[model samples]
Target: MTSIVSLPIVIPLATAAGMLLVRRNILLQRVIGVVGSAALLAAAIKLLYVCYTEGIQVLQLGTWPAPFGISLVCDVFSGIMLVLAGIMSLTTSLYAVADIERRRTAFGFYSLLHILMMGICGAFLTGDLFNLYVWFEVMLIASFVLIALGGEKPQMEGAIKYVALNLIASMILVAAVGLVYGLTGSLNMADVAVHLRDVRQEGVVLGIAILFMAAFGIKAAVFPVFFWLPASYHTPPAAISAVFAGLLTKVGVYALIRTFTLIFTENPQLTHAALVVIAAATMLSGVLGAAVQMDFRRVLSFHIISQIGYMVLGLALFTPLAIAGAVFYILHHIIVKANLFFVSGVVHRLRGTYDLKKLGGLYATHVWLGVLFMIPAMSLAGIPPLSGFWAKLAIIRSGLEIEAYWVVGVALFVGLLTLYSMTKIWAEAFWKEPASPGPIGYASTSGLGWMVVPIVLLAAITVAIGLGAEPAFEVATKAGQELVNPQIYIDAVLGGRQ
Candidate 1:
């Protein structure tokens, strides 16, 4: 199983290289991208099964020992993330087949996308901080180009905001890495955790943690640092936006969870408390931003930030159940959010605009689209018996268990506001009558099949998750247990080398 651990990373890297060689052939590029993504998904599912059945799997590069050479580790958490990445990657590739213009396709869009997947998978699997930073840089380069691929004015403007803020985040992250190496004399996460236990410079350590929090926080788009997400996320093609929605920010959140739980556990009173506050603020701000948005994509973009708060709430509570909730929320949010963006893309194709005021009567005319949109939309809003309901319930229940009343109250309030935003989109974009029909040349379903297929599959996944919440929750619980007590991860990465 350890031999299979690197397949997720390798497949994308190899696939992207292959696509680059055939960049002129859009058909071949699409074929390579989709097949590679399918392979990655298969590898991810295998890894998840291995982690569950066998225990944590680790592969030390060049057979080097921990704290010395690179290590790729897959625990339940990483396995779960890899699975989500695979889903998003495959779906995005499918959507891009029909949605992306030939000009963009010829411009190495598929190559860059696979490169992005490599980075995301690397981030998930790496067992060290320096490599994590390297992966972040990899993602940043790919995403910047992906966002600005068309060279449109809006894309350029949005790309600038996204890249500028993220660059600051990158610099801060590398600086934090430097400090961690300087203090602990190690870059391996497991090794660093062990070293930090012996260090006595509490103040310096706390400062480093804060720096990490800021760096990953910006990457995660938490609280005041999240404006970049809303400004830029809606500017990309729907396929690109869907992939970003599903995986990018989640990487940042994953970093936070890994560091806070594994390496920075000593200062929970201050660090975790600060996290709780940030989570609440992030939740409120995001929903409020969504409440007034006029564009369909923009509204979803803002809600991404809002939903992020719930995931963080799971981390901030720092309990086993909370961690479980966070894991569950991550699982639910990625599929539902990605599908919403996919739905918006279909809407845009049909109506020639993302403006909510311009779209209407979709529910009456395109009844399947309406049902597809509502499945994810209602799930996002935490409607009962759906994925979001159970995800939010676990997080809220966790908060209530610890009497974190203030953040809990904020969470419930944010859910209500989230529903309002979803309702607003439904009323404006689906229920009301449009003044004009879609533009010519888009009435046929010739190209839409590839795009809608992913939406249908993702929506089905959402429904399945809702109906079979027990087994999914069990997976989340085991993942949460691993996170809460990270000794298993540490031992796997260290390989008894300590």
Candidate 2:
């Protein structure tokens, strides 16, 4: 069980090292990336199954006991996150085979990608506040270079903004971790939770809580902190954007969920209330931003911010059902969001520009492509019988259960606005006539199988989740139960020592 807990991070770490060793052979690097990511996906699934059937699994490094050694913990929630990370890693690696340019490949793209995955997995799996901070830095370094990989003018501009904000977030994260250790004498999250109960500094506790929130909030791209995401995500290659869209911000959200539930459960009236406001504002602001964007990926990027609101709202509501909703939303959005980006890349392959005004008539010529776009686009809009619908339904319904009518209303309105944005993309990019043919002529099917295959697989998963919402929701609901009662996690990590 402990070995399974570590495999998600180990597989990627090893793959990245292998890729580096064979830097000159792009073919070998691609093979290692794809095979390694697939193994990661398998391990993630096995980890989830073990957690669900057995209970939370915890690994203390070097045989050291709790509060004295590093811990890797996997509860149902983290296991679900690990599975989503695996799916995205595998698909993105596949997509990049055909999508990333030769120059980027030769420049260690596969190595960087695996490193990013390793960081993300470590963040999800770590049970220490300081370890989480370390993973954040790892992700930051890798993603900074990834966004700036092409060295294009826009990529550089976006990378600068991305790194600048993240570095500040990183500083705050470290400070918050230091505060936790100072107050609790433990960097272990479970130990911190146990020790915090003995601390009498109410003012300092809440202050530290807010500091942590601000730090993770920036990385999660909520509310006013989200400007960097739209500016950066669109500038990268589609494969990079797909992985970033699926995993990076969610790592921040994962930290938020873990910290608040396990370490900062005190004063929910104040802490969770702040989250509610941030969630509503994030949703409204993101959709509004997306509504006006003419660029394909930019619109989708803003929608990512909006969709994050739904996930956060789940955490804010702070109930079992609500947490389940959040878990479900995070899983659903990862697949749907990445697929949407994949579709955008395919569109770019056919049409030279992301500008909506200049792009047109994909439906007439590439009927399958239009259908592919609609599945995720409609899912993003929360249409019924799709994955997004169940995800949004859970969140909205959870809000209603708690009578959070105002935020619930905001959520419903955001859904309507989301629908409008999807229609805008559909009308401009698919339904409307192309002002002219593709500048370089349309790509043949033979040239697109690598990219298209990943999109198809993700789309199929979205549909599966939608159609299988009950079982899917069951998984989320169980995970939510674990979160709503953090003792399950604490007990797993500490094994009664605390």
Candidate 3:
């Protein structure tokens, strides 16, 4: 099981090194990228199955005991994330085959993609704060390179803001880790949780908690700190944007959920209450901002911030069902959001523009494309019989259960606004006739089969999860149960050592 837990990180890191060596052969690079990501998907599925049946899997490096050695731990929550990382990695890698130019591909794009996935896997699996920071740095380096791969003017501009804000986040995260170590005398999260139980520095602990929140809030792109997301997300190639949309900020959200539930439980009233306010603000601001954007990708980017609020709201509500909904939402949003970006890329390939006013008649020209776009778009808007519908229901129902009517009202209104934004895209991009007379700007679909495959597969998953949600819901419920009860994780990480 420990070996299985390590496979998600190990597979990608190895593939990245392999890809770097074969960087000149574009054919080989694509093969390696696709095959490697596919292999990772298999490994992640295996890990999920193993963890589900056998419980949390842990690996202590160099055979060192808990709290002394680096540990890789995979519980139900981490398992779910690992599975998501695998699916997105494969899909984005496939999209990159067609979307990325050969010049960019030759310059180590495949390598960087694997490295980014490795970092995400490591972040999900690490059992200690120090390594978590290390994984964050790894992700930052890979993502910075990937975003700035082609050196386009907009890419560089976006990269600057992205890197600058993230560096600040890294500094704060490092500072928080140092504070936690100084206060608890442990870098291992489970061990720190145990020590904090006996520590008497309540005020200091609370302050450190706030520091963590701010640092991760920036990474998660919540509320006022989220400007960097829309500024940068639309700058990269759609494949890059899709992967980032799917995985990056969610890593921060995952960290927040893990730490708050496992290690920072003492100040729920202070911390969680603050999270509730932040969540509502993030949702309203994101959706409202999206409602006004005319560019295809930019609108999707802003909505990322809005949908993040729903997941955060789940964590903020801090109920078993709310947390479960948050988990389900993570899965649903990753698929739908990434697919939407992929669809944007496909539209750009066909129409040569992302401007809504300049683009139209997709439905008439490419009916299949229109259908693909709507599956995820409608799901994202939380329409019935789609994955997003269930995900939203979980969070809203949990809010209802707790009788937090104000946030619930805010959430429901935001859903309506999200639908409005989706409708705007539908009307402008697909519904209306093309701006020009006949055959305005359709590109050849030659060699685009790979790109279309992933979009269709992801859209199918969105529908399947909606119609057959019980299994996913059960997994989410079990995951939320583990999150709400920290003893399972603590014991897995530090059974009798402490």
Candidate 4:
């Protein structure tokens, strides 16, 4: 039997290569894409089971010893992230098959999609800082191509700004890596973490930390670095945008959490305080921005920033429960955010416009689509009995436990604003009367099954996570413990070597 350890990266890379070979055959391309994603999903589920049964699994690639060759480590956090990325990619593949008109363009899209997944999975699993940076580039380059693939004016404009900003962020990240390498004489994350503990140059450490924050913050779409998201996200095809919304920013947040917990612990006071302020600003600014957006997708884009604040708040608190909450929130947000974007795609396919003012009466024509949209929207708004509610509850409860009164207040206020914004989308897109008496483009009666299947699956997973919170929370907590300790991770990466 093949080891489950390397499948995440291997499957995607092999599949991308296969697609490249068969790029001229449209049917084969789609088959390769769907099969690859399905294989990835299966592998992720198996990895999750392995993690549950056997604990964290670490694989040093090429059978090389740790800290000498590249290593991939899987724990609860990376395992769950792998599954989420797989789900998003799988669903988006189905939606693309049904929605994309240009078949040739789709081959490239799917190719990039697989490469992007490989990057995300590698970033999550890698134990080396330089490898993580390489994965980050993989993600950024693929995203730039994906965003610009459509060749529309809006996509072109958005891709330009996106490319420029992300390039700058990447450069800063490289500089940080160089600085850390020069300081510690190692590029391995665990090695750096161990060395960082004894270093006394607070000023230099703070500077490097800030560089990382700025770089990852841009990728994650946090405040002050978040302008590009709303302006460009709505321009892509719904399926492409859905995948990006679901997986890309979360990668950055994941990096931030990993670095802070593993390597930057020496300056907790400065690091935590800075993250706290950013978290508060991220929440307030994101929600308020969402509240004013009339475009359905744009509103959701802004909410991504707001919800990210909750995750970062958990990190800033730096408590066990808070870190677990952040993990849970990331899992919750991935599913809910992607499904919400998928719903937007469904609406666009049926109604021919994403403008909320021009959309209405969807509930009457497409009852099931309305229900699908409602599941994620309500979840995103943090309604009870859903995953989003528990995620928010975890963060807010952690905040209160730590006496972060202002963070708690800001979180609650953001929740209310989130609800308001969700309601606006619901009322404008579903409840009100349609502008035209006749049915819209697709009539909402046909070609929707493909779209709704994925949304329904994601929503079901959200509910399942909430209802089965104990195990998931346990996994998240374990992941947090590993991160907070850093010894096991560092040893796994660097131990038994000269």
Candidate 5:
């Protein structure tokens, strides 16, 4: 049972080792990759069940105590994130196996994908700040390789900017960690929270918070720091891009939530005000940018920034319901956003280009594809009877309760803008008639069951979550409570913090 804490890392590390051994055996490599991802998914589910039945679990590596040894803590928040990461990795692995053209590099790709997942899981589960930094580096290196895998010109270009910006962010993150360690004499998050309660340094704490925010802001694709995302995200293959889009930014947001809720809770009045302003600007700018985009993938990429604002907005509200809504929104966005990108991959495979001008009237020829795309897109746009609507309702309800009229107004406005942008894609791609009818000129591939399977599965999950909101909301509420009350997590890690 103690070893279960490491299953997330173990599965991926083992898969990477196996891939290296069977580099020449393509079928074996694929099988190993899928098996590894499936195993991780199972582990995540089991972990969630453990959280529900037995409460929070903490594992200290090597049996050493906290503030001395590495610790992994699983609260409801970490459990939910684990589950979401597993689902995305599993589905994306399936898509990559079938859709990727470079077979020789496929093993390497899966290895990197698993490595990224390992880092994400580690980051979420770990209770130490410095350990989280190490995981971020792991995630970054793997992402660099994944983005640049094809050696294409655009991918290379995007990878360069991505790596450069992320490297700088990493450095800033480390410097912030050093400052926090210097101030608190500890690298463990639980320890830092306890220390901060006694020591007071207004300027230093705010400065460290700002540094941390800047580093995570770049990673989260917030407002001014978001240009790199739109520029780089569309360059990768859809499978790669979908997973990156779905998971990477959310990790940054997760860090923000964890850090603020635990360590920085001392001054929410100041932090919340700043976060609310940032959230509003991020929402407006992202949607406005999406409205002008001509490429389908690019449009969705910009909307990622906009939708992230909603999640951050929930955090800014600083209420239980709002926080729960943010948690639920993150889960919803991961599935819907990834599925949309996969649908774009299918459309690109069928129609030859991602430009809206070049794509039209797919509804007539490919009704299934149209329907598949519509479900997630409409859900994203906050149409009723979908998962997106519930998330929005929760956030807005919280905002109104807190008398955050401005934030609520911006959220409503962003929701409408989201609808408009999605409708633009629908009008251009599916509804409008294309210039030519039979056999669009892209890479016409026949058995695309692997690609379609994941998309359909995610789409179904999206609808299921929408219809089954009660249970999902319960999980999210539990996660939110755990986040707000960090003592349970701290105690689990440090043998009961004071």
Candidate 6:
């Protein structure tokens, strides 16, 4: 079980090293990237299965025990996150084969991508606050390089903004961790949770909690802090944007969920109330931002912020069903969002511009492509009998259960705006006739198999999850139960010592 827990991070790190060693051979590097990511995906599924059947799995490094050693903990929440990472990594690696240019490939793109995956996995698995900080730095470095790989003016600009905010986020995280250690005399998350119960410095504790929230909030891109995302995400290549859209901010959300649930519950009235406000503001602002954007990728980028609001809204509600809604939202959003971005890339390939004014007739020419785009797009908009519908329904239902009527109203209004945005994309990109139409000349389909397959697979998964909501919701509900009761996690890390 421990071996399974370790494999998610280890395989990617090892594969990245292999990719570097064979840097001269671009073909070999691509092979390793795809094969290695697939292997990691398999391992992630296995880890999820083990956790589902055997409970939380923990690996203490070097045979050391408990608070004395580094711990990799896998509960249902982490397990589901790992599986999502695997799916994204595998699909993105496949997409990059056709989507990333050869110059970028030769410049170690595969290595950096795998490194980013390793960091994501480590961040999800680590049971120590300090280690999570380390993983954040690792992810920061890898993503910085990947985003800046092309050295285009916009890529560099975006990378600068991305790194600048993230570096501040890192510093804040370190300070928060330092505060936690000083107060609790521990860096282990479970240990900190136990020790915090005995700590009497309520003022300092809540202060530290706020600092942590600010730090992760920047990473999560909620509300006022989200300017960095829309400013930068659209500047990158579609493959990079897809991965960033799917995983990066969600990592911050995962951190917020973990820490708030496990260690920062000293003042729920103050803490959770703050989250509720942030979530509502984030949703309204993001959807409204997307509503006005004319650029294809830019609109989708802002929508990411809006969708993130839904995920965090579940957390703010702080009930089991609400958290389950959050868990389900994470699963649904990562797939639907990434698929939409990939579909954007496909559109870019056909039309050569992300500007809505320059693009159209996709549905008329390649009807299958339009159908593919609609699956995830409609799912994202919360259309019924689709994955996003179930996710949005779960959160809205939980809100009703708790009588959070105002937030529920805000959520429904956001959904309507989301539908408008999706319709705009559909009208401009797919339904409207191309102003200047012919072949819509671009790359040949021969090279696009790698690109198209992943989009289709993800879209199918979206529909399957919607149609098969029972098991998926069960998994999310169970994961939510684990989060609502953090003892399942703390006990796993401490080996019953707590």
How does each model score on lDDT? Answer: 0.93, 0.92, 0.94, 0.85, 0.89, 0.93
Shift in Å, residue 108, candidate 1: 0.9
- Report the alpha-carbon TM-score of model 2 versus the true structure: 0.99
- On lDDT, who's better, 1 or 5? 1
Query: All candidates' TM-scores?
Result: 0.98, 0.99, 0.99, 0.96, 0.98, 0.98
Candidate 5 achieves a global lDDT of 0.89
**Using lDDT as the measure, which candidate wins?**
3
Which tens-of-lDDT digit does each residue in 63-127 have in candidate 3? 88889999999999999999999999999999999999899999999999999999999999999
Clashing pairs in 3: none
lDDT of 6 at 185: 85
User: What C-alpha lDDT, on a 0 to 100 scale, does residue 268 get in candidate 1?
Assistant: 97
Candidate 4: segments with Cα more than 4 A from true spot:
1-3, 104-107, 438-446, 496-498
Report the lDDT tens digits of candidate 5 across residue range 1-498: 878978888888888877878777777777888899999999999998898778888898888788888888888888899999999989988998766766525548888888899999998888889999999999999999999988889999999999999998899999999999999999889999999888777888988988988898889989889889999999989999999999999999999899988888888888878889999999999999999998999999999999999998888888999999999999999999999999999998888788898789899888999899999999999997889999999999999999999889999999999999999999999999886765456567665888999999999999998999999999999989888888877787788545
- Candidate 5 TM-score versus the reference: 0.98
Worst 10 residues of 6 by lDDT: 438-447
Q: Which stretches of candidate 2 lie over 4 Å from their true place?
A: 440-446
Where model 6 places Cα greater than 4 Å from the true spot, the runs are 438-446
Over 1-498, each residue of candidate 4 has an lDDT whose tens digit, in order, gives: 325778999999998888888777777777888899999999998997787666678887777766667778887778888988888879888877766656535548788889988998889888788889999999888888888886989999999888898889889999999999988888778778878777788799899999999999998888789898888887888888888888999999999999998888878889888899999999999999999999989999999999989888888899888998999899999999999998898888888788888899989877888888888888899998888998999899989897989889999999999999999999999999888766455534356777778888898888888788788788878777777777766765665653
Q: In candidate 1, what are the lDDT values of residues 55-140, reduced to their tens digit? A: 89999887888879999999999999999999999999999999998999999999999999999999999998999999999999
- Each candidate's number of clashing pairs is 0, 0, 0, 0, 0, 0
